[model samples]
Target chain A: MSQHPDSPARSNSGSHCGRVWVIAMHAFTQLVRMKVFYFLAVFAVIAIGSNFFDLPQHTGPEVSGIAVLSSIKSWSLGTMTLFSVVLGIVATALLLPKDVEDRTLYTILAKPVPRVDYLAGKLLGVLLLVFVSLALMDVLMSAVLQIRSSMILNQQMDFAQGRGWSAAEIASLRGDILSQGANASLQGAVFAVFLRASIMASLALLISTFSSSTLFTSIISFLIYFIGHFQADARAIFLESGAAGTGPVTRAISLVVSLVLPDFQLFNVIDAVIEGQAMPLLILAKLTAIGLFYAVFYVIASWFIFAEKEF
Target chain B: MLLAGAVRLPLEASLTGELRAAGLLPAPLAIGTRDHIGQTSSAVALGGLRTLVATFLNLRAYTFFTECRWDDVAGTFDTIVELAPHTIYYWETGAWHQAFNASSYYLNDSNLPSLRRDAAWRASVLNGRAFLERGIRNNPGDPKLNAYLGFLLTDHYKSRAFRDADATFLAASEAYRIAADGRDALPFLRRFQLYALARVPSREAEALALARELYQNRANHTVTMQCVYFSLESHANRSLIDPGSFAVSVFGSAQQAYATLTHYWLRGSEHLPVHGVASALRVLEAQLGIPADKSVFLQHPAQDAEDE
Candidate 1:
């Protein structure tokens, strides 16, 4: 069994990974040159601007410094969600048609590369761009949040000490303030954002495989993104719709849609984490597993449709 | 495609179950709220910016607040908190709007008849309290909301909203105690607990014990704390405690004791037990050479302390 130095199985696996990497890097470079990273500058401005929104007009004594931290997180994460999903879909949607128009698709497909590799490489590329962009935005957000949180903590500490807060009370106040600041949970939230975008990129790739135009792919992907949130509801209804006395035809339709659609709401853990709830590592693992599950399914699905298609 | 779908259906089901059990996903947006937020926002909210939608709703709620649309304010906050249940600010701000601002508006609205205004004001206060209680249920470990609840319940000017003065003070004291139980609760919160406890007629003994514990540290000897300490001791023990000597010892001087005790004496709405306040004031007035007409005795004690 060990006699062969090079086997076709080993060669195929190695070449598949290598080809995917090459195409992925190429896609990354293409998207990067599009000036997509400019959004980080806008994100920087937003992360900084959210610090000054000391709304409610009255910063009462009971108002801890956590409110501003919460705002910073909400605004920054919200912006990241918008940017990542849009980039995921649009970048991925553009990759196939643009490559075909540039004849890169034919040039690559003329080689030994599989369509799965081509699609996966393109998706990985869009994801890489999204991951880098989100990472930069996360850095800006974490830094802004760190500086602002420290300033607020100092002000709160002064206020607490002036009012003769106990050591325990001061410690507790510090804990509460720090909870809303940059931490592991916040990082997890950023990762969750990336996971969501990754799924979107793969879904867009699936759409782009058969889509007539980039606009059609983008529109359909966006529509699916929105509808994906309701997939859970549809699934729930389909599950209970039978027992709940709903018509069989409607239940059958819901079941079909639910089976077809990805449940985007599963990634809404970002909202929970931003609201200061700790996301257990197990939940993140489950989310990542599901994300991978979808990405793999969609990529394979794209390859299925694209495998025998003409230019 | 069919095989992939077959494999994914069960996996997605189990993942959804785990996520739902983990409380990561919120309930679906109500159709009414969806219509209100409009199609674009509904799309964004459903696309995972529920919190951003909530933040925008907060701003809209603020506008409603400024316009004095109390029902709209309440409705918007209801939707906002539902979207971001763990956000303390929305809960607190919403409760405050209902209890204080909305209630105040109802009280002074010239268009409403007096009787209707009274009912509306009472309803607003009750609604605000219910909202805060709901927030507490959502976030039981939060000290600020607990302290806010205590402040709202025990507010002297707002006492007309509650039926039972003593029971209300007891509830307030309990809320303050819970807030103070948090390791980060300010030192004043501990004394604030004693203040609320002092007003509870049946809790004087417990309040006295806490006051004594706080009094050991010279730093806890604020004027109110001193007055509460003197009042609780007098209320607990009928004899052997000379009010003047106790006040002087707590306040550190005869003139300061008189001034502080006299101020405490006049705050009738505060519900702090008069306890030895009057007796201490009488002795202080005699020693200070104050005229009988200027004495604290002639000043009408607040009915709050007497009612308890």
Candidate 2:
């Protein structure tokens, strides 16, 4: 709450963190002021309303009330996630540019707030907003899951009791409806995905800090997102094993290419999560660490560059 | 009789006597064939991935959301990936439908086995192989896909399964390695390094070297957060481990699903063979996780992650 610089009593280490916190809060409030959040809220509501019949047409006799509810819930969360990401990318990219455009940043910079402090504050604001959006969607999804899973369990019991059951029925019915929850890899993957998105956002922020044009930052950031994700595919091609198909130059090129881009593929564990696959915590922690490392790397890089700009 | 089951009118589905009289479509097509959401709102927009093809949703279409159609949808699969390609659930399931959604019972099943067995199989394998090969071109850092492509290759192109298949699989294994290597954290790279070094001429030594370094710089308190189900003891799960969909041999390392098919054909690893037609059924069931018993599958909402 209070920035007490060089406080020997509490350790002078992160006295600046107090300022960062305050700035982050300020940026978040601005996002609300810009009405981007309202736009997202409206989109989320539309997503929920768009679903026609919950049961997929191709499913045939498989249609059940529980299935309809699940599909709708999934659609709603998906829509929310989609809108949030779009908003995040659009909103965060505006960080540097908006300040430059309206001459708002020059005024802010006139105050005691240093450039690093400003950058960190903007990033924190974005990260917090992203977290809140994700959390809101998670709550919505988890609620639907809990309800659907419970209903399924109930219906299964009713079906078994009322119509009677076979040995196969007893075996298939596991207590945990999310059979994938049984696996560690899946759960780890979901966490990794979250962390990965954060890293992507941080990278976007770094680029935004330098570029005064919102269009350039968004385009480059989007390209980076594509390259980062597809980097895995690139390495797979150039580095095909052994001495048989490829030559030394190809291998050299592959090695160089691999190092250049972020491998966003590692963060992909959505299949594992949906399939009820096990996701070990170590996997999640490892991914989180990687994501944080990248995020920090970008932050420091951006700070170094931002500290230099003539404006 | 089938018409009688759902709709009250015997001859009054989408095709009806009027539309068929104009010769627009053949007799007795589902209302979906005529773009009627059948019983729901708008042909339900045929939601769900096309069987084994990975289709992306066009974000640009969001601007023209009302006019978007299956054919008009730009980069539909891109939309899906943009939403969140990391979710294997969405990728795997969406891809399966993209590549294999039996788009036509429209073709005569009676004419299938005898009529076009070799041709169809060849066509399927070629497309599958192409998908993997394309991934090999567009995305090479992804190691899992190479193995997945390898898995598909071994299944489709078993002729290449020579005496030194390990060397070949190693090529495919590179996908996993690059994916691992991309991490700022070295454990991911080291894990694959184990799998890589395992095949080295001097196995024990390579493993020993990698192991010692990894153990010394432990993740400390953050170790517990690594796995999703940190509580679970083992590292692999059936869903995550096998992930047997899109694994036919011909597609080798090529992730032939919605966003990008034939994820890895360049590495050329052996793929698993799920050859039965019922295997298609299994693809629909397991990969999609659509329980044959719809009720259970339906009970679970689709991805609630806001994005996949």
Worst-scoring 10-residue span by lDDT in model 2 chain B: B225-234
Per-residue alpha-carbon lDDT of model 1 for A39-150, expressed as tens digits? 7788778777787666643236745556767777888999999999999999998888999899988887776667787888888899899999999999989998999889
If you assessed candidate 2 against the hidden native complex, which CAPRI class would it receive? incorrect
Candidate 1: fraction of native contacts reproduced: 0.55
Q: Per-candidate RMSD vs. true structure?
A: 4.0, 24.3
Residue B304, model 1, lDDT: 41
Give lDDT for model 2. Answer: 0.45
Which lDDT tens digits does candidate 2 get at residues A61-145? 2123433433443354335434544565667798778778788788767766667777888888877777776666555545555
Which portions of model 1 miss their true places by more than 4 Å?
Answer: A1-12, A38-66, A150-177, A239-247, B1-23, B110-113, B206-219, B239-242, B245-256, B301-308
Off by over 4 Å in 2: A2-11, A46-52, A57-81, A167-171, A174-190, A237-253, B1-308
Q: For model 1, which pairs clash? A: A168-B183, A169-B184, B268-B302
Cα displacement (Å) at residue A302, model 1? 2.0
Look at candidate 1 and tell me the lDDT of residue B88.
78
